[model samples]
Target chain A: MASSSEPSALPTLLVFRVRELRFLAALRERYRVLDFFTSGSPLAAFLAAAAGGADPPRALVTVGGDSVRVDAALLDAVPSLRFVHSTGAGLDHIDLGECARRGVGVASSGTVYSTDVADHAVGLLVDVLRRVSAADRFVRRGLWPLHGDYPLGSKLGGKRVGIIGLGNIGTLIAKRLAAFGCVICYSSRKPKESVSYWYFPSVHDLASESDVLVVACALTRETRHIVNKDVLAALGKDGVVVNIGRGPNIDEAELVAALKEGRIAGASLDVFDKEPKVPAELFSMDNVVLTHHVAVFTTESRSDLRDVTISNLEAFFAGRPLLNPVLHS
Target chain B: MASSSEPSALPTLLVFRVRELRFLAALRERYRVLDFFTSGSPLAAFLAAAAGGADPPRALVTVGGDSVRVDAALLDAVPSLRFVHSTGAGLDHIDLGECARRGVGVASSGTVYSTDVADHAVGLLVDVLRRVSAADRFVRRGLWPLHGDYPLGSKLGGKRVGIIGLGNIGTLIAKRLAAFGCVICYSSRKPKESVSYWYFPSVHDLASESDVLVVACALTRETRHIVNKDVLAALGKDGVVVNIGRGPNIDEAELVAALKEGRIAGASLDVFDKEPKVPAELFSMDNVVLTHHVAVFTTESRSDLRDVTISNLEAFFAGRPLLNPVLHS
Candidate 1:
């Protein structure tokens, strides 16, 4: 289908990675969709051909926080690439500094999935605190009548909850939990003036005061492994951790060890250091709640993402401000 | 140790169905705790002997909403019984009308457990909507890497949540879920003038407009099987139901049928029609999250309950008002 002789008015939207095929149709209505997936060419050869061609894609769109690295080398190959729509909340896979240096306009799925992600964080937190999943298994295994009542769970009311990053997602999680009568506190690089929640200068201090520690920060050099061994130790044996942020945000090995030794009470992990490959030790732990990285993935959020992606692309082509511009500096 | 009779000034308090032994010591501190369990006699015999005694028990305190029926027969046996302290929230186990007629002053756990129950309700709601337990199971089975991403869950935001019975627990559940961007509405005997949440006169109407239905009402003749086949059908295919209320509040047979037939999306049940004996048909369903009815059972609440129980006892003996009087005139 690469035998186009006519120059259509629609701008080219070079999709790097999008597994959700339904979104492609909505995109095709506006843009000349050049999906890399359907092209079925090697990564190097595809770039070479696109680079060598007369009309290279000027705007690119991608989805998910996958293995695709939009780095300096890739930017060099696609010299005409001026605008990028990540269509995902996370920009870890996309090299923001490189993109900024190249004068590329970057947009992401701004606040679109925040509610979903936050709701999931609270869900995981509740699951960990109340042992919802463990009791579910016990009943399924027919242990209720045979074994009598399940173990009593801890109450959520009056317990201190320390959020690692009080961004859009973190703030929402705090708001939802506050209604359950949980005392709120947070840890960030700097305290957010807009909120009255107690701010902790360090993660260790936050963990020490918190009955539950929720990680909702982004993945960056300074933030990676923020919830390390010492922080987990400070969290104490009665403490629980809920990570809806990036996997590397918490030291996974340290968490596993903490769980194994009962240094921490429990954890609810949605992301892993090696995602889709959760540590096998967590399999048998009734204290921990595990899920494949899907805090932001939902049918409702998919529509929101598609809208954010298409709107950013449309705005870029119309010489308007990007709806969700990243690289603030 | 059953010691020799000593003329203590403390009044007698007959104890029943307190499995938490730690709470027992606290009760003994205030009064002469005559435990029915330690009597080693049948319930009928115990009541008979207590009735025959020169100093018949005037006050009774109980916990855990168990199978110890506090009815007219027992009330008749202990004719001197004036102050009844049911330390659990649900008064379905006790005949409230009979107690009122007999001039027995009744007090309960009051608002002490409302927060815990409400928190659990929201926890169960999120679990059902987001499939937290199922996802945990999938990740634990090591199916993520092999099977790719687990199925996407429905978002909790913008969800129409219908809470049946807008009492203290239900009101708290509504409040907590409202902060998650959920549209709150409820069905009760009558519309509550205090809260601004939309009121649905019938359970079916509530289910019709709701994406999620939370059964938070108490069990009674009128309320039993309130969430029957019609109500569940009206909830539709994308709808989920959460029960932190009594199990019989929802018809187990009807609910099982709906789940099996895919009439409703899912359910998270902490209670069952035949508690401690959950429906075997629900054992294999991944959509249903089950627990052995421990929503209000927490270590923190136990302390609160102990305090409430002791306060009510002291108040009764000191000729003051009951702390959590139920069966209002």
Candidate 2:
């Protein structure tokens, strides 16, 4: 409990949960932490008590990947809250429009996890192109000795790769693949003036010219299902798709049907429309590689994320500019 | 059968078998193809017939990966052989010293497959670091929804990577990883003069400083089992290894023991001590990613290899210099 009498006492930071012990310990060093979810108190009672307190918590910190909803109704309960911080790069779970209208500033761990996510996207692409995971499965099943030669995989070099987004992560993916002799192009909202990679106005045109299509865009209304049936058809039978972005950025059902009918050659996905519940058909396909939503979940990235998040919270309390502010349009 | 009556007839090309129909069709366009294994002729009878003819076969072309031994005995049997061409970069199956002494020109597909090999090596490294294969296995086993969250992986950026051989394949690998922000160093027979990557004279010291060690050197008596127990110990508990080179580059038994005991973090192996005979212990380990010697077995590389092999054979028959000659020490 933070004391009202002591002027030197630390401020309170309200959180739903604390998954990392190190992150929790570090937060506790600067602020008095209140975990509403872990405290076993009813949410209504906790909110009422927090609202009645003389010095209520002014900032809220939350971890990503739990689908934690922070809507208008919840914000109305915390009148003293002026800042919200998410320890992840994705802002899909946070209602940015609502936060902006309420004059609440939002911060996320921006670009701290970009290198890791790009590494994972390239990893999945190569795995699909060279059959790394599929061959690993084949060798693990003791089928190599029984079966003579594993099927030949396509080469990454000289293949046309179409990136769906040319953001920070997508740009890094392009730079890495160029070293392997791959021809790079992209289909972003508009052409990035700095890059020389060929740009297509639409994803369909990009998919038609690409041997592999990588989805790395944000999950907005315009970008949702950006890779649908038309795009898959354009990618053709020998094309591969690698998705490291949010799941909804691609049409999951259409992707499954394309893979099932061999309309597209293969796909390597790290995110699903409803994660932890991947389509059962993908389990049996040797051409497909499926992983949990873990592109940014690395030990090094997590440490960086913790630092960025703590800094954002500290800056908000100290009346300083946030390190990674999510500017609302 | 080549007709001796015609002086301008194409030269004969002797092969044990013609596995790739396309390669065989392409070769027959320029030469009289003789496949002893497919012809069902006795080995001695075939050799005697090939040698006794007036227009004896002057060149031999063979596909790689079958361990088809081209030893001193085989060379002695083919006294008229002027050239030997292998459709792969590796020359372990062919006796280079014997070929040099016999004045027989040898050609291999030099850097045609270097880009693909480097791509697979980096793919395997990222897979091992990001748990790409392991996470795929977990998802396939229906564990992600049940287990709640998969374990975190290590990051690839800012890690020290030590390459065992700074040959064509290794240098390309360093170039690709440099784009990912990894610190690159290497250990080879001798430090290369053109590049500025740090060099270590011994594998022990190289492994001591590397977060990941990639083996990409050729297989020789002095190079076999170069990453032995001592090197593994120096790599410590957090080090990873990726081998895209020939089998036996790393001691199989010692690597298995170290991985099982957690002496090292993880490994991604594309080759083993025995082809199609991976150690059963590695099958169950989650920290290891195994493939069936497929680093260079891509469709595009195969096409390039066919062209290189055919070019070498054509050059030999036409009394021209070989395209990619293997210099014997």
Off by more than 4 A, model 2: A1-8, A40-55, A327-329, B1-10, B36-49, B52-55, B64-66, B327-329
Model 1 lDDT tens row, B1-329:
14115455667778887767788888777777778877677888777766666567789887544567778998998888888888777888888888999888888878988888888888888887788998988888888889655668889878999999999899998899889989999999999999999999989999999999999998889999999999999999989999998988998999999999999989999998876888888877878888777788788887898899889888888888777778532
Tens-digit per-residue lDDT, B1-329, candidate 2: 43334455777888766577898889878877777756667777777778777778888876555645777888888898878887766888888888889888888888988988999999999999999999999999999889556679999888999999999999999999999999999999899999999999999999999999999998888889999999999999999999999878899899999999999999999999888799999989888999988888899888988888888777777777888988421
Model 2 docking tier (incorrect/acceptable/medium/high): high
DockQ score for model 2, please? 0.85
Candidate 2 pairs with clashing backbones: none
Residue B242, candidate 1: alpha-carbon lDDT? 93
Per-residue lDDT over A1-329 for candidate 2, one digit per residue giving the tens place of the 0 to 100 score: 23323453889777767677898889878886777766567877776666677678888887555645666876788878888898756788788888899888898888998989999999999999999999998898888989656789898878999999999999999999998889999999899999999999999999999999999898888999999999999999999999999889999999999999999999999999987689999999999999888898899988888889888988899889999998421
